[model samples]
Target: MKILWFSNIKLTETQMSGSGTWISGMNDLLSTYYPDVQIANVTIAKVDTVREEIVRGRSQWVLPKKTTAGDMDLFVKIIDSYHPDIIQIWGTEFFWATIPFETICPNVPVILDMQGFYSSVLDVLYGDLTMQEIIRCFSIKEFLRPSSSLIALSRRLHKSVNREEEVIRKYKIISVQSNWVKGNVNLLNPKATIYETRIALRPQFFQAVKWNLNRMEPYTIFSTASMIEPTKGSFTLLKAFREVKRLLPQTKLLFAGSIQTGIRKSGYMRLMEQFIYLNGLSDSISFLGSLNTDDLIKAYLHSNVFVNPSYAESYSLILAESTYLGVPTVATYAGAMGELGSSKSLLYFSKYDYRACASKIISILTNRELAVKLSIQSITFSEKKHDPKTVAETQFSIYRSVLGQLNK
Candidate 1:
């Protein structure tokens, strides 16, 4: 079976842009586990013309992001050439990816994969920011960029949400990673078939040594974000961290992500800086600018607690990986994070409730017995959900069922 994938990231490199870290693993596992399946990935790049490459026996296509008359013609031509038995459009956030759905061979089965569904994400775009904070979070850079602030993002997300609804209604089958996404998709299209699926993790996570209390840095916390935007709930966590600081002065935070640069700096970042400065948290907080997988895993293994303060997430890959590494974590009860925990594995606090969030973080940091319990359970839950063999087989099964290959 030839499967064609439309995604935002190319799988040819270690650091391809976008959120599908599992694509490479999925491709490899499916190829190894089920030899009959042939897969090709198509992604959009800023290149002037279309390009193609072979990566480990799979075809990789890079098309121009801008759709010119010739570009659409060429895109259609490629689709005709591949003649895929299954067309999988990964992540609906990029509206351009779904452009060829009906235009291509309509008989072929199509599966929509949810990555932080814009429709549900639209509801929590501002995270915990109040109207006053929203106004305060606006900066000259945000004014210049216009789209960086929460206000502009809300408008853009509203448009994306409309597109998402259309896509959701048109597709009969979709694969979701979280129950939160399943519920929202049901609201949009009740008749649509939903498959609960888990994405594979990078090998580094599975191979790395599990969290050991002896190796952990006392009073140290670790967190991650692609970009520390307001919606990521950075400020919400900052507020809680301040309270934790009072109780535990030695507590330190290591944020692993790119720091906001000259143009990228927004009012929200400025607001966070002020929060840190005004609260005397500058000495306690450290930002470990963009790290590779090895370095990220090292940070996770060293920290006492991992925190996810996002206002929303369809499924947080960081949380998943950390939990698998046996890191005790405290997360906000926002987005699908609320669905990520049981009484045994993870701890949760309501969004924007800094006091409650602080309490949870403190509980884990101070209680060694509780921390070890969480660590053990976290691994148990995460390893089960992210088992590469299980994920690959489940995905192949979905494809088989779609193509009526189940009985055979």
Candidate 2:
């Protein structure tokens, strides 16, 4: 079988973001397990450069000439040349780009991976912003800037949010990472065929890491995100950390994610820095500034607990990774995080409640026996549910089922 995959981010740039890592990991799994299958991956390029290359053992990769309006023609020509059995578009942000596919590849089955619904995400991020602020934040030029990729992507996605029922009706199937996302998809396209496929941890995360329950860095709390966006609730985390510090004076909060510094500093970054200074947490809070997977694992290893203060998530990949690494976790009951922690392995608190969040973190940090129990439970759950082989097999079955329905 042949498959053509479309995503805004290149699989080669997997280390940069969450969706890229997911695409890269899934592609690797398919290549390793289903050797006979032919896969073509087409990604939007950052610059006005085109490349068609065959990696040593991976799929044929096609990067668009550019992300401009004129590049759509070149992208469609590449798709036609591949002659794929099915087309899988990774997210709804590419709805405009995929419109031509319906007429060009009429017989080919297309599957839309509902990574997350843009409307739901926007509701969380801009929930507090006024109409003027929303407009100012998402101008047309911002949507075209490659430097602001996430915002640009979100802007495009927002355009299609109301039209999802009409747009998704064209696809043969929809794949979602979690039941929470499936719920959102159902609301958008009730008739759409939805498949729930949980993402697996990368092989690196599955490796055995020693869980030092007895000897951990004193009162160290760790958290990570791809970027310090408003949706990530970094401010909420800071507030919660302050409460935790009040209780335990020696506690330190370590953040591992990208932060724009210097002149290019974002307004949010400035606000965070001001908050830290105002709260007199300069010494207790530390920003690691975007660690790679290996370093992230090390952060999880040294920390006493992991905290997820995000306002929403389709699936908390970092939470799963931290749990697998054997850190007792405390998270807000937002989006699919509750589902991920359904095994009751981690402590849960109401979203945006700083005191409650701090209380939960304190419980985990102060109680060694409770922390050890939660850590063991989390590790066992991650190993069983996030096994790479099991995930690959399940996804392969879903692909086969989609193909079978298309044949019928």
Candidate 3:
């Protein structure tokens, strides 16, 4: 079978984010197991002028700007040339990209991989910020160039939000990573068929490694998020870390993700920095912006505990990756994280309660037996549920089922 995959995220060898890891893992597994199947992974790149070029050994179709009719025509041409048996579009964020293909190939099977909805994300991220604050945050041109474009694109996509019912109504299958996302899609289109699939960790994370419970870095904690957003609960983590530091003066926090700085700094980031300064956590907290795979693995190995204090997540790849590495975790009962790790493997805290969060982390850090038990359970859970082979087989089954329906 020939499959054409469309995604907004650029696939690169050095990519470290969740979406990047996901695509890379899936591609590797499909190539290894389903050698007879032909897969073309396509991504869109912004260019000064419109053209097609091979970027980093992958086909990148360049568009002059966001969502244009010309780009849609080019995509249709590519699809016709490839003549794929099935087309899988990665996320609804790029809903505009899928419309033309769906229109042109009415008979061909189209699968929509629902990687969380943008509308739900906006609702959570902007839940607390006022409309004025929202406008201000998006208006900072120099610092928020990417964000500004995102906001503009979201507005254009908003028109399709309600129209999604009609678009998805025609699709034979919709794929989601977690039940939480499945629930969201059900609300959008009740009759649409939804498949719940677990995301697998990369092969590198499954390598044999020794877990040293007795020899841990003294009072160190690690946490990671894709970007500095209000919904990531960085401030909540900071508050908990401050309390933890008071109880154990040697406690240190290491954050491994992109933190906005300079004039482009978001309000939440500024607030977090102010809290750190006022509480004298300048030396206690460290921001390690965007680590590569090797460095990220090293960070997880050295840390005594991992904390995930986010307010929401569709499915947290970082949390799964950390737990798979046998690091004891303390996370909030938010989004699909609770679904990812069980109470036996992960300790859950109430969201936005710094004291509660801190207390849980402290309990895990102080009790060596509990930490060791949780670490073992964490590995056990990951291996049974999140192995790449299991995930690949599940996806392949879905593809076959969809194709059978198409033939009928």
Best by lDDT: 1
Give lDDT: candidate 1, residue 251: 99
Cα-based lDDT for every prediction: 0.81, 0.73, 0.74
- Per-residue error for 395 in candidate 2, Å, reads 1.1
What is the per-residue lDDT of model 2 for residues 1-408, given as tens digits with 9 covering 90 to 100?
Answer: 888887765655344444457667777677777877777777666445677766535455545444543455765777778888888888776643346666666788888887766676766764333455345544333445445534554676567676665666566588998888888777767888888776866666766575687667969999884233567777677888899998899999998887775555554455567679999999998889867777777888889999988888888788878877778999878888887764458888877777888888899889999889888888788778777877888778878998899888
| Candidate 3 per-residue C-alpha lDDT over 129-216 given as tens digits, one digit per residue, 9 for 90 to 100 | 4566455545344254654433554574476565555556566678989988888778767887787776866767877473568666
Candidate 2 Cα outliers beyond 4 Å, as residue runs: 13-19, 68-73, 95-97, 126-160, 163-166, 208-210, 225-227
lDDT of 1 at 194: 90
Candidate with best TM-score: 1
Model 3: lDDT equals 0.74
| Model 1 poorest 10 in a row by lDDT | 11-20
* lDDT digits (tens) for residues 244-278 of candidate 1: 99999999998888787776787878878888999
Q: Candidate 3 versus the native: TM-score?
A: 0.88
